[model samples]
Target chain A: MLAIEDLHVWYGSSHVIQGLSLTVPAGGAVALLGRNGAGKTTTLRAIMGLVARRGGRVRLDGRGLESLPPHRIARAGIAYVPESRGIFPSLSVLENLTVAARGTGWSLERVFETFPSLTERRDHGGGALSGGEQQMLAIARALMTNARLLILDEPTEGLAPLVVGEIETLLAGLKETGLGILLVEQNLAFATALADTVHVLGKGRIRWRGDGTELAGVPEITRDWLGV
Target chain B: MLLDPTFLAIQFLNGLQLASLLFLLAVGLSVVFGLMGFINLAHGTLYMIGAYIGLSVARSTGSFWLALVAAPVAVALLGMVFHVVLLRHMQAASPMKQVLVTFGLIFVGLDSVRYIWGNYSHGIDLPAVLAGGVSVLGETYPIYRLFIIGLGLAVLAALHWGLERTRLGALVRAGVDDRETAAALGIDVGLAFFAVFCLGCALAGLAGVVAAPVLSVYPGMDMSVLILTLIVVVIGGPGSLKGAALGALVIGMAQTFGQVLVPALASVMIYAVMAAVLLARPGGLVRARHG
Candidate 1:
């Protein structure tokens, strides 16, 4: 379980995330939907401690994670997959996976099994992999950390339709395995399908929050807040 | 004269010897700059300290072998202290600030060595076992120079194996590739970088001890080798191991052969090579992938 309350972040004079609060229950999915520069990415960054949070209380399973470093936060069971996929270009596919492996639950064999495309290119450099494969490798790497919570930023962005379907299927399976996922996505269909609850963000504030099914009838939220 | 087999063979060996020293000096500088983006102008100071420490150890123990081992360990420990106390703080500072601080450290290191040992050249006695000459191409050559070449190759091989086949090497590669991602994956990058920094310092010490017998230990010795080492890193591409190896060899052979072949232009030939390399590939022979 993850809980973030009244998170405030600033980039010099510009306020990025202003008093945002959210929660993801164990084995549940929460999707943050917003347009460009709506602070969705900033919220994820604040949770990961990549950016300094001026004010916030982040708790993972009742323990405070506000002051921890990024590495410490990761080890505490949060695995972050950035928008770029964060693959080490010089490292081989296998090295990229093993570099962050926590030696529990997800073994190299399991990852290879889960991602057969990756298995074939185990010796290939991470940079050499295609966009679809890179995204798969990123998720697979996150799993290798044995993390209970997976934080993904725009995993479906710039992906092919067929590859998007594959990723959606893979994530659906992961959701069934009781892994809590907090996803920031622009694809409304993908987000609504995978997430149990959806929150539309507008100008660093949550404009609407409700069940994924309820979001379909509320066209105004999607039109005004998410710019759909 | 250039066609003479014996003369060419001797020059070839001389070039190798110079390359060996350059490799030992440049590898650490390359990796540190590449991984942490820390411009350590004071790295050569470690080499000078290693030589001074080696001289002291050899004099105290009357054993060149003992000095070789003791000097690197001492310098590495000293480097660890410096990193924790000073260098680590500079990691977040501007590059200009990092340069100024490290450059200041070069003077501090130089003045410290002067205050302790005074401004005079000293030499380490060649171990009796390696004191004699060996026959090569119908001419005798110093075995110690060959030993230097062998040592360099051995270190290179070891480094190659360590970096390619080990988990620590994987973490380092990952850190070098993307520090933020590596950290977010739960790697203690700061600790790993600390280990690397100490190793770099140790290698510099090894180079200083190894070169002392041939180059002799002297005041401002760090400055001369620092220039050559920096040139090697620049030409090799900072952060690339392969680049450092290739760059060191290139510079080493160029400096060695330049001295004999173009006596008038020898002093500026290495600089010319560097400029030509920059013109061809501004990123150097091998580029660090991320930046």
Candidate 2:
């Protein structure tokens, strides 16, 4: 479970996240939906303490997380998979996994089982892998931390439709394990299918928060706030 | 043939000895440049510090072994001070500024050495134990030269094992590849940078102390070694261990052989080799890749 309250983030003179607030319940899959430049990414970054300048409260499992460094937050059961996927291209697929791998809930074998494509390319350099394979590696890398909360930023971006479907199935499987996921996404239909709760953000603020059942009747919010 | 077998053998040994010193100077440069992405022009100054310290200690105690052990320790401490007081602040500054600052430090370090040791070149006498020459291929070679080569090889092997096989090496590799990600993974980048800078300078110091017997210890030694080490780094590829060794050997051998075969062109041979390598691989032979 995670909570962010009245978060304000700034990049130099420009304010990116202004008074944003949201929460995810224990073992819940939450979708953060937004159009381009809506501060969705900033909110996640702020939670991870990657933002240079931020003011607000971020709590993980009812404990204060705003003051901690990214690694400390990670060690405290939070794993962040950035939008760029931050893979070390020179390192092999297995090296990438081993670099972050701690002996706990997730092991190399477990990751391989979760994403079979990764197991096949274990020795290949991260740079040489395809986009889908790279994304899979990224997710598996996050899983290596065995964090209770996994924050993924656009995990399906630039993937083939079939690959995206496979990823969705993986997420569905993860959900059955009761792993908390905060997925920042643009695909409303795909997100709505798996996310029990949805928060639509616009202009550095949360415009709406509701369950998946309420999403169908909110075309006005979708068009005006999300522009999808 | 102009290359007599005995002369060739001696020259080959000379080349190996020079390569060993070059490795000492460039390995630190490789780590500093690779991990921090900062050009530390004053690294050679740390080498000079080692030479000065060795010269002083050897002069007072009349013990080569004492100087050998004491010089690097003193220089390493100085390096730590330099990192803590100066380089740490300059990390966020522009590369050009960093270059200028470290360049300024070279002059300061050189002047400081001159003030302490005087401008005269000090000769370090090899210990009697290693003073005698050994016959190789019916040609007598200085036992000290072979010692230098052995010491250099040992340092290289130790560094390779320490960096590639240890957890510390993983942290360092990760830090160099991406500081942000390394920090995110819980590594304190500032502390790691400090520790690495000190280690790099310490290695430079070790090189200086080791070479004091063969190479004359004086103020301008830093500039000479600095230029040659820079060439080695450029030729071998920046931030690459294997590249440093290969570059050092190539330059050392070429310089020695050129001096024999074409004495007039020996001075320019290293630059020529570097230019050729750059032409082939602009990024150097080995490069760090991003994920």
Candidate 3:
């Protein structure tokens, strides 16, 4: 479970993430949907301690995370897959996986079984893999950490239709395993399909919050918040 | 021409000897720079300290082996202290500040050595068993040179194997490639950084200890080796072990053969080579994959 309250982040004089707050229950997915420069990414970065947080109370399972370093936050069981996938270009796929692997849960063998294509490309460098494969490897690496909370930023960015379907399927599988997910996505349909609750962000504030069944009737929210 | 066998053999052995020592110094330089992105100009000071410490131990115990073992451990411990006391404070500072701080440390290290060792040229005697020369291909060469070569190769093999095969090496490679990403993956990048800094200095110390017989331990020796080792790391590629090896051999052979041919231009040939390499690749012979 994850919770945030009145999160405030600033880059110099520009206020990015102004009093934004949200929560995700165990084994559930919470989708934060917004357009470019709407501060979705900043919220995640502030929680991970990658960027400076001007003010926020971020808690993972009721424990405070605002003061911890990035690595200590990681040890608290939050795995982040950035927009770029964060694959090491020089390292082989196997090394990339093993480098993040915790001692227990989501063993290498299980990961191979889950993503069979990764097993074949185990020795290949991460940079050499195709965009879709790189995305798969990125998600697989997050799993390797065995984190209860998986924080993904645009996990489906720049991928083909079929690969998107595969990723959606993988997320469904991961969800079934009772893991909480905090996803920042641009694709409305994908977000609506995966998330238990969807929050549309507009100018560093939540414009609307509703379930999938309620989203179809709120076309104005789509235009105003998401500019869809 | 390089076609002459006897001349080739002699120069080849000489090249190996120089290259091995160069590798010892450059590998640490490469790793330290590659992983932490920290520029430590005083790395060669570790080599100098190793030589003095090893010389002192060898003279007192009359055992070169004891000196060899003691020197690296002392230097490594010293490196740990150096990292914790000073470098750690500047971890978030700019590379220029890191370089300037480390550059200042070179003078500090030199003065400390001068105070302790006291302006006397010191050389560790080769153990009697390895003191003499052995005939190889109608040429007699000191066994100690071969031993240094062997030790270097052994260290290289260990490093290559560890980096390419072991889990710790995987973590190191990951950290070197991207420390932030590695940390997000649950790795303690700070711990890994400290470990690597200490290890890099230890290798430098090993280079000094092994090179003592030939180089004669003395103050200001750090500058000459530091210059050459800097050139090696630049040419070889900062983060690459193989690149360091390649760069060392290239500089070593160029320097050794240039001395025989031009004599006057020998020391500066490596600079020419370095210039040529930069003009060609800009990133060095084997650059790291990511910037």
Candidate 4:
């Protein structure tokens, strides 16, 4: 369970996230969708304490996370998969997963079992993985931390269609496992498929909020806000 | 004399011994640079301090063995204090600032040693256990020098195991690869950096203590060793363990053999090797992850 109240973030003189707020209930999925430069990524970054928040509060359950650092936020059970995936090119696939591993809920063998494609590449360097494998590795690494919240920024970006399908299926399965997910995505269909609630972001503020299924009936909002 | 097998053998062993010392100094410099992008020009001063500390312990306890253990531990503790008090703040500072700050500490370190230890050069007596020469390749070599070589290899092996097989090593490699991401993964990256800086300091101290019997221990002794350690890191590639090893070997061999083979141009040989390596591979022998 996570909640954000009136979040404001700035990058120097330029204001990036302007008084934004959203929530992802326990075991629920919330998707933040918008066009490029719409502050979708910044919102996630601010939540993870990766960027300085000019104003507002972020709460996990009931505890405030505004004063915490990135590592502290992560330790508090928020696993962030950045836009870059952030895999260490020098480390092996197994090392990348184990480096951040925390609890008994997720083990090395468990991760390998879940992603059979990665089992064979355990000893290979992270840089050597294919785009799909890297994306899987990123998700697997998050799981290793036994995090209660999974915050993913554009996990499907630059991925092939088949890989995207695999990722979507994998995420859907993870949702069934009761992991709270806050996702930022440009892919409308993919977001709608997994998200229980959808929020369209425009200019760093929430412009629309509705059921995930209701978004398909509204074209004007998509055209004006999402450019989709 | 130059073509004699015994002379060449002795020279080879001498080069190895020098390389071992250089490796001890260079590896720490390489890792610290790689982890934080911070240039510690005062590393050689740490080495000199180690020798001074070792001298004090040896003289007071009359045990070279005790000095060997005490010196590195003291230097490591001192390094931790230095990092917390000053270097930690300069982590995000510019390269010029890092260079100037650390370079300033060199003089401070030298003068401080002089103030306490006097300007006269000192040496430690070799322990009886490692005092005599051992026959090798139809010649004899000081057991202490051989011990340095063995200790270097042992440290190298230990380092390799720690870095490759341990969890802390994985965290370090991950931090070196991407600092922000490592933090996001719940790793205390700052702590890792602190540990690495301390480790580097301890190794330099160890090298100084180990070399006390073989080299003069004096206030300004850090200068020549500092320059050579820098070259080793550069030619070996910054932040790479393998690079440090190769660089140390090349420079150490060049310096040792060059003295006998080309006494007139001995001072220029190591520099020439660095230039040649840079010309071929601008990133050094092994391109480190951060480099």
Candidate 5:
């Protein structure tokens, strides 16, 4: 379980993630949906300790996480899949998977089974992989870390419909294993499919929070904040 | 000079000797830059310290082996201390600031070496086993020079294997590719950097110790080699061991071959080759697969 309260982040003179709060319960997938520059990514980064948090109370399973470094926070159990799918380009796909693996919640065998394309391209360079394949590699790498909480930033961005479907299935399957997931997505359909609870972010604050069915019925939040 | 077989052969051997030494230093420089993105202009200073320490140890112990063992270790410890005390603080600073700090250390290192060694050009005598020349291709050559070549090849093989196959190598490559991502993956990036910087410095020092018998151990020696090795690392791709070795060989061959074949242009021929390589590839001969 992960809980974030009154998170504040700033970059030089510009203020991003101003007094935001959210939570992802055990085995719960929380989808953060918003238009561009809505502070969704910043909120995830703040939780990961990648950015300077001016004010925040990020708690993971009752442990305070605001003061720790990114690596320490990760070791405490949170895997991040950034938008760029940060694979070590110089390394082979196998090395990429093995290098990030910590406690081994999912073995390389399971990862290979899940993403057969990764196994086919095991010896190939990480950078040489296609966008969809890279995204698969990124997700596989996150799962490899054995972190209970996964912070995914636009995991389905630029992916084809088929690939998106695969990702949807993958997340749906992963959620069954008691893994907490925080996803920032623009694709409403994909997000709605997996997320039990959804929050619409406007500017730097949570504009709306409800179950998938409730959100689907609220046309005002979808139209005004998400521009959907 | 025009078409002499024996002359070319001798130059070829000399080039190999030079390359052997160049590989040791260039690999360190390339790796340090590749791993941490830290341009340590003072790397050559560590090499000078090695020579100075090796000479002193050899003088007191009367054993080349002891000097060889002690000198590089001392330099490594010194490098670790420097990293902990200073370079660590400058990690996120601008390139100019980092350069200024490292460049300043070059002078400080030079002064320290000078104060200890008394500003004279010193040289090491080859161990008794390698004191004489052996016949190679019917030409007499120093056995110590051959030893240098052999030592360099052995290092190249070990480094190549250790980096490409081992767990440590995976961690290092991971750290180099993306520090934040690597850290997020539970890698101690700071520790990796520290280990790499120390190893790089020690290797540079080892080159100084091993090559001291041939090279004049003087104040400005570090500057000349630093410039050449920097060029070599650039030519080979900044972070690759293969690149460093290839660069060293190319530069060594260019310098030695040019001296014999085109005596007039020998001094500038290496630069010409570097220019040609850069113009063609721009990324160096061995491009790192990552950005």
Candidate 6:
């Protein structure tokens, strides 16, 4: 249950997220699909309160989140997994999980159960992990927050096909648990498979918003806006 | 041969003693720099404060132990006050501004010490119980110097344990790696920074209190230790405890050996080692992982 209305974000003078609006109902998986430089990531960052300059409203369950600091916004039941997968490289996987684990119901054992690869390499430093392992660790870390809403930016970016399949399965499983997810992705097929709703963004504006079924016949929209 | 058995032993002990003092100063410097990313050029002033407070407490109480325990506590409290009043305001400022502000505080601290303690160098006489020396490898060493070495090792052990084994240490380590991420995890970053700044200042004060007997208390003592501590931090690598210890030991031995074997280079030996280390690693002896 998150609603962002006419959100505007800027980096210095460049307008990033311009008049973008989106809504994710409770227990829904919403995919924000866009090409490179289409402001999908910026929208997620605005929601997390990490953007330098922001305007308009970001409401979570009817409470304004735009004015809150990143930490405060996070504490109010949102977890952000940034595009870069901001893992503390010097920390062990277990240490990363431990640092992010805040409340009950998201213990190390539960996280390990969700991502068993993390349990196997629990003692290894984060930097030493492979891309797939690191992504798992990052997702597991966000899950440890027990966040009501999880914002994932490019969750399957730069991963192998097999690993991408694993991530898809993971997302499908997570969506089944009634945890709301806002996924920023460039992959249409993967997004269609996991997302209940789809929003196509182009030039900092949302061009389309429909059920996943509508994404099938939009060839021109994909070529012009997504270049895929 | 210039290296006789007696001479070598004495040099080794001297190296150990110097290492102990350097460790005390450098670890504090490391924590302050590592956690808050604050370049507190005035940290050495807190060390000077410790010596001054030690002198005043010892003079009044006539007990070396009283000064030892009380001086650092006083300095720690003062450090907390300084963080609240000064550092908190400067947290978001540029590093250059922080440096200038801290440098100004150094001048103020030196002037305050001079105003209170006067210009004369004050020394503490070793307690009579620790005044005597015992035969060590058939060589007599001052009991106080040995005590300094032992105390330094004990402090190092305690610090290592507290930082590496405790939950608080984990929090500090997480904070140092990424302050924003640490905050996101519900850690009170501001409070942690304040506590760490005070702790670092307290260590500097402890160094001052411990070194008061060996080095006389005076105004310029701040500059003297400040320069050397910087060298240690640079050579050891920023924000590394083990690196600081290694840097201190290396510099201490270089200084001690220089004084004995090549007296002219004794003053510049630390700089030479730092230059060599920088030339090799360019990032200091230990490199912190950056995101």
Candidate 4, residues B93-154, lDDT tens digits: the string is 99999999999999999999999999899989988999999998878889998899899899
RMSD (Cα, Å) of candidate 6?
Answer: 2.3
**lDDT winner between candidates 4 and 5:** 4
Candidate 2, superposed: residue stretches over 4 Å from native: A61-69, A102-104, A107-133, A160-166, A169-178, A225-227, B56-70, B272-281
**Cα lDDT of model 1 by residue, A1-228, tens digit:** 999999999998888888999999999999999999999998998998898545879999999999999999999999999999999987899999988899588999999999999989999999999999999999999999999999999999999999999999999999999999999999999999999999898899888999878998898988899877
| Model 4 alpha-carbon drift over 4 Å, by segment | A52-54
User: DockQ of every model listed?
Assistant: 0.87, 0.39, 0.72, 0.86, 0.67, 0.40
Candidate 1 per-residue lDDT over residues B1-291, each given as its tens digit? 976989988998999998889998898899889888899999999999999999999999999999999999999999999998998899999999999999999999999999999999999998789999999988999999999999999999998888888998888888877888899999998888888888889999999999999999987899999999999999999988888889989999999889988989999999999999989999899997662
Candidate 5: residue A52 lDDT (0-100): 60
Among all windows of ten consecutive residues in candidate 4 chain B, which has the lowest summed lDDT?
A: B282-291
Residue-by-residue lDDT tens digits, candidate 6, B1-291: 467888798889999998889889988787677656788899899999999999999999999999999998999999888888888889789999999999999999988988988988999777897789978778898898999899889988887887766666766776777666665545555676577677777888989988998888988898987888888888888788887888888888988898888888888877888889899998788775444
Model 4 C-alpha lDDT per residue in residues A102-154, reported as the tens digit of each score: 98788988899999988999999999999889999999999999999999999
TM-score of chain B of 4: 0.98
Give Cα distance to truth, residue B125, candidate 3, Å.
1.0
Compared with the true structure, all predictions reach lDDT values of 0.92, 0.83, 0.88, 0.92, 0.88, 0.84
Candidate 4 interface RMSD value: 0.7
Clashes of each: 0, 3, 0, 0, 0, 0
Instruction: For residue A48, give model 3's deviation from the true position in Å.
Output: 1.5
Q: Who is ahead in lDDT, 4 or 6?
A: 4
Candidate 4 clashing pairs, residues 3+ apart or interchain: none
Clashing pairs in 6: none
Alpha-carbon deviation at A139 in model 4, angstroms: 1.2
Residue-level lDDT of model 5, residues A49-138, one tens digit each, is 888645879999999999988889998999999888898987899999998687855999999998999999999998899989999999
TM-score: which is higher, 2 or 3?
3
Q: List the residue pairs that clash in candidate 3.
A: none
lDDT score for candidate 4 against the true structure: 0.92
Residue A69 CA displacement from its true place in model 3, Å:
1.6
CAPRI rating of model 5: medium
TM-score leader: 1
